[model samples]
Target: MDNDTLLMVVAQLGGGSWVWRRSGGPGSSFVRHQALGSGHLRRPHAVASARLGGHLYLGVADSSKGGTSTVFRWGSGGFYPHQTLRAWQRDTHLEFLELGGRPALVLCSAARRPLVYRWSGGGFAPHTDIPHVPDVYAAKHFRLRGSVFLCLTRFLGDAKVMRWEGSMFREVQQVPARGSMVFQPLLLAGHRYVLLGNDFAPSRVFRLGAGGRLEPAQELPAPTPRAFVPLAVGHRHFLVATSFKGATQIYAHVTEDIGT
Candidate 1:
């Protein structure tokens, strides 16, 4: 892509290769680009792409027990290997964030604590780790009321919400969950809400209530829900829910005024 077109890259779990497709347009087709991967890569789990310093950086998670995950940089020719994170087991997610005017990367693993790496002009270096965060399946960073917060979804324990306290993130609230996998925060009708998806229980939508707390709003009917994503079309908002064992569902936002 020439920075004007959107591209989607998918990392395969069994083949360890990445397939990329350009967004279809007037003359452009949805043709897949050349697969990217080395022979050493195995069990690719997730990939995250970001633009830093005017360059495209791609972070890929290879979940093999003793394999290394890699970050690739886009250059004139193509994407080239830039950095390597070694000795991670079952790495599941990769996310890039800009914190305090510095580029940072968050890597999550199933068997180890999540780590933060900051860009240091030359390469990404280890910055910090989220304490007591094990079995972390996903992490999302959001801003609320001038404060930045991180939400961690655990597969075996309660999901946690941590707020940035000038230096580091401290736990502010815990949401009881079992087999929690997705915690997506969104704004609907000028209200802050979070969609919680679990594998063992019904998914629920929680809204920010008084005292900065989250209160349950509605429960989804889908079992083993995996992801909840918000989509906006023109001026309307909608939610899409995907489940592991059920059909995908889309819900449109509606409102009604009650007489006082």
Candidate 2:
């Protein structure tokens, strides 16, 4: 979202669309600007938006059984359909990242291998696939100790962490997980940490170790955890965890301790 515009994408059960709103300032009310989509969009699952070279790019995923996903570009007067990409049974997440100064899009699915597409001046093109990443529900990219890493969360098996090895991403570590869906990265007291959420197991926190590995730090009480985020109020910091089948929890920051 920019200072003058707010972009939002909606996933309709049958058809999906993207909307843009414009506001006068920080506290002003926003008015609808425009909406765009294609008739082929069905069960849209995720939308990733990015701005490059003064233009906006949007990647939308459709999870319908045989529906194809599409990328929209801002042109002429509004967003126009750009590229249509094939997705699997369920496209769960879409992430936008810049690797080696090139814009890229990462798509995650539950039945097909995770795909990465690079922006090729004219349009986005298939770049590579994350091998063995079936059942992937989410993907996150973070930098640790001057190195970039990609973490893929699976809903049936172990979550894998891959490091960008100059040319491509290579698997570096795996964290035991079951029904995992999200990986939330946070920084606390000069240290990096990752919170793993599983749909059928207890949530966990992993700390960056000496050799770039992640070590178990703490276990959360979340049953069927789904999402996590770091929050701050006044001078106190807190960690919030949301569960799909249990109560939401808030953890306070207690020097050297990851709140209970």
Candidate 3:
């Protein structure tokens, strides 16, 4: 979605997928695009978009039909199926990012280790797998000091922040976050912070403390929080939180002085 073109792509669990495009300006309604109908996809759980080689690509993860994911190319009319990725099954999330200056996609799975695929000039190919990570719900990637890191979120036990070590990613820090769905890392007001959204416990915010370890910052009373997004307007900053059971919350980021 953008200022000029607005599109909404939906992934359905039982019903198929569809794409809706806005035809007019503000207050206009969205209509289903004729190119992508409901029967085009089956049981898609996640969708992500990326641009590579001056072309826009969309990835949809599904499991009902046995094929793991499908990549679609965007044309002047609408999106069309371009390729299919059949390596992993039952994917929980699909994220697209740049890895080592190349376009890449990370597929998180609940039944197998999370896998990363890199664009190979023509299509995406399997590049590496995150070892020892099973039952992952989502993976968020960020760059720090010219290095790449991934926050692997899980529903049980501990979540880990892994750093790319030239060859593969290794665990740099582990955080105890049972029932967590997203460990989102965000940079706000020139400080690094990570938000842990939990279903069983209160959601926590951690700051990058001394020695690069994440330290507890604050806690929110949001129940079953799913994701956190940073929003800024003019000079004021705010954090928007989405929850599964509770209402969506917006928190203002304020600064206080503790002068000696």
Candidate 4:
């Protein structure tokens, strides 16, 4: 809510990998915080999402033979305590969810079968299992009118939409998402919008409507034609973080509300 145009640089330090996030503010060039995570032998274990209970969950695609996952949960004194889950060590994929007034996260295999995990009195526990679909490439969550929705794209180049019915994620009926357009599967803007990037076509904003979907909410204006840049979103603002051509420039997602 400050300068509205802040550039952030990310780096890995001393076996520490962090996402140094910055935003511009008054009298100050930037406001920044580093979301740090533990390092693995080959790749650093990083948290992908955090819950309202103050839990920071780390998600990684465990493709390596010895790959593992570590998720941090908020404990006493506002610090995230690490809780390592060995079940996801092989091919676990992670996504955050807030369904039915409870903060949760979605876990799946590289095969793309989905499972819902909600924070309980004891760390995080399994809530539900989504239908099995192999080789799923991307998954995202969104909400409308207090209902939770989930959308995922498959490796076969298609998108799947599901809605939480106070119990589990069920396939949406009578909706049309090709499952082809969802490419990168990254959640942006505080975990409410789905960003299309990587192999995702149209590389734009996909909002969850009555159900989980990828309908365009906004089309980002590019200063120049480019590709292969990292993207992130915050609430109504979408950031196109790209180091293409060797410079980091961030863009904001806006509709008519930007200049206001």
Candidate 5:
């Protein structure tokens, strides 16, 4: 595949295996098939599917159960697993970002005192401990524009958004910082807006403000967030490859009233 062409990862199913479909040419649609996800005792806790240097990089869990220092990256007909830490952990999550003008894969371990890992020098290395965060016991990284952010849900503490500022993460500017970070947030609306949650009442909306700030923009009228990521490109195209009740679905649309 050409470096300029994008091989959009369609679905991540069956542990390490991924379902990918190439998009291009005229009148072409998403072609589906399976790859990897074989020969494993432990299920993947975190997964990162990205194209770095003309080849796809698939990050997987080195162990199925917690309490093991293991992270695996796949490419070129093989798998490379590394133990960045000594102790065991759980819910190893991965988010790929461009850090310092290079491909950086951030890993967050789910432990009593969780840790963060970065992929560099062709292996996994410790980046730094997230400040002001006692523990990111369960957190996921969100990339808006080029910066990386984490929405951390803490135990017995308030959940906050941590922004990566080339050095470390700081608290995101939230209007109601003390309120509940309830909804399951997903990047949507051409990556400009984020669909926060599907609460019992109504859906809350948030738009990324200038200087990497998150401001309460609008409400979704309904309470359900149907998509996870933007399926198609362009400002007019609205799409989401989402999972609802353990089932996979594709949602797309073209909008006319993009900006007001």
Candidate 6:
């Protein structure tokens, strides 16, 4: 690791957000660094971290009525509030990605279409909007064959797969995902897969199939899963899933050689 300090920001729905830092190497416990927006933050939904110009920045999104999201920039002393973004009271996710080789942020909301903001040397500025999509719970980006794609999870309707063209993103695929909350795309064992988590149904996994289309592959018992993270140790692969109403599950990836 280039830096010895690891920073994590936690967002709360009722309380404010907090920044925790861990110094030194492995097994170092994290310590609370600072608390922010104690009386102002309400129903914070998500927190995102990014590195720009060798500096770390953290953003928190809130979904309560009249709530606003805030971005903090790290300084020599500590992290301080750098910018405030409008959350529209229904923002559900904050995603940091690279768009056109520049740092960008996407704010997904249930109230309206998702908005894209690009870093403008000093702060993030509105760049575009993902039109005609509403009630989105989360947005995740993945790269395939030198192209970037976005998977959007909808709370009411079908989930969508969007491809980024020169200037904007266009819908290319849709999966029936009513009541879905998370659509996480990950690369595992040289293959690409997407996990769709639903509140009313079993979570489904889709693999990248022929012609770059997503094909249904398997199902998991994690209902109302919020996130999926892929991990590898030695020659084994694992997947960690967090559920909203159940215990967190860890799954092993085993390849079965079925004779043709």
Give the distance in Å from residue 9's predicted Cα in candidate 5 to where it truly belongs: 7.8
Error of 6 at 100 (Å): 1.3
lDDT of 4 by residue, 94-210 (tens): 676677667777765564366677877556677767775555544666566676667665545445667788888777732223324343334444445554443323345556444
TM value for model 6: 0.93
Cα-based TM-score, every candidate: 0.91, 0.86, 0.91, 0.58, 0.62, 0.93
Note the Cα lDDT for every prediction shown.
Answer: 0.78, 0.77, 0.81, 0.50, 0.51, 0.84
Model 6 misplaced regions, further than 4 Å = 38-40, 210-212
Can you write out model 5's per-residue Cα lDDT over 1-260, one digit (the tens) per residue?
A: 44544344322334444544456665566554444444431445555566665555665543344334344454443444433343445544556666556666555554543445555656557677766655343455666677777666543355667777886677884333222223234555545654444423344557667765667766543423333455546545553434333344344543458787
> Ten-residue segment with the worst summed lDDT in candidate 1?
14-23
Query: How would you order the candidates by lDDT, starting with the best?
Result: 6, 3, 1, 2, 5, 4
Clashing residue pairs, candidate 1?
Answer: none
| Highest lDDT against the true fold, candidate | 6
Alpha-carbon runs more than 4 Å astray in model 5: 1-41, 52-55, 61-64, 67-87, 112-114, 134-148, 151-159, 174-191, 198-201, 221-227, 231-236, 239-243, 246-260
Query: Stretches of candidate 1 above 4 Å error?
Result: 23-28, 209-212
lDDT of 2: 0.77
Q: Candidate 3 lDDT, tens digit per residue, 45-126? A: 7788887898878888775535557889887677887877764477778889887888888888777788888889989899
Q: How does candidate 5 fare on TM-score?
A: 0.62
Residues 128-245, candidate 2, lDDT per residue (tens digit)? 8888668788888887667777888887889888887766778888888877888767776456888898776668889877645789988887777777778888888888888777
Q: Candidate 5, clashing residue pairs?
A: 17-37, 42-64, 67-88, 67-89, 68-88
For model 6, the local distance difference test gives 0.84
Clashing pairs in 2: none
Q: Cα-based RMSD of the predictions, in order?
A: 2.1, 3.2, 2.4, 7.7, 5.8, 2.0
TM-score of 1: 0.91
Least accurate 10 contiguous residues by lDDT in model 4: 221-230
Please tell me which predicted candidate would have the highest TM-score against the true structure. 6
